[model samples]
Target: EPEVTQTPSHQVTQMGQEVILRCVPISNHLYFYWYRQILGQKVEFLVSFYNNEISEKSEIFDDQFSVERPDGSNFTLKIRSTKLEDSAMYFCASSLTPGGEGEQYFGPGTRLTVT
Candidate 1:
């Protein structure tokens, strides 16, 4: 079965640098989302995109963050400027909205560490 794949598995960056995390969502899926967990916190939704525009976004998706479908299969998240609080496990997810239950399938995640 096809699955979402994330790169680097782990990343380390300086507080003021930029970082681009990569993901390949399930081949046949449509809805894509990014969520983060700050070590022991709940999974917080960052943004959701569909039909080439953002469908919904949370307050955490500030000016420093962006998402894109760079190609047919690759989805990426870029943090323009990192901060120490930005460190977290960035998860890329996708799901089929079969009746709107929204059971998303998540990638292993890219653990971002800012120093």
Candidate 2:
């Protein structure tokens, strides 16, 4: 089946450095999002992107964070400065629409380990 794919399944970064994680959405899906999952914790929504702009973002998406779909298919999340607290598995997801009966599809996720 068609599915979203993320690159470099795992990343180890030093604190205070920038990191960019990449994802490719499922073909034909529209709304895209970024979510974070801390070890043994719930998946938390970080930001939602649609129509080339950010539709919604959580408090965790502060000044140091940003997302972009530079190309029609690939989506990327960038952290200006990595922090220890930012270590987590980051997932990329997409749905046919912003909201409705359509289900969301998620990528395998990029495990970011900041130290």
Candidate 3:
């Protein structure tokens, strides 16, 4: 059984700093996405990457946010700058698009704390 994995399960940073969250999904999965959940708020979609390019993105994915697959196995999400409001739980998910009805598998998630 394969699953998505993330590093630095917890991170604490100060405002104006930069942070890069890492994730590794099942090798065969075709679609990857990043989402964030603010404390007591709904989960918000940030971005989705497929075929080495962004397939879909939400308004929340501003210029400060970027994602990349540096190798065949690793996917990364980099936040150029951290803001106090950025504190949240960031999740990485992947799915196998067998017939376009893909059910995503999510990682444990990285909790970001900004002060």
In order, candidate lDDTs are 0.92, 0.94, 0.93
Higher-lDDT candidate among 2 and 3?
2
Over 2-76, each residue of candidate 3 has an lDDT whose tens digit, in order, gives 999998899999999999999998899999999999999998889999999999999999999999999999999
> Please, what are the lDDT tens digits per residue for candidate 2 over residues 81-103?
99999999999999997754688
Model 3: CA > 4 A from native? 98-100
Task: Looking at model 2, report the run of 10 residues with the lowest lDDT sum.
Answer: 97-106
Give each model's clash number.
Answer: 0, 0, 0
* Candidate 2 ranges with C-alpha deviation above 4 Å: none
lDDT of 3: 0.93
Clashing pairs in 2: none
- Residue 91 of model 2, lDDT score: 97
Ranking by lDDT: 2, 3, 1
Q: Which ten residues in a row have the lowest lDDT in candidate 3?
A: 96-105
> Whose lDDT is higher: candidate 1's or candidate 2's?
2
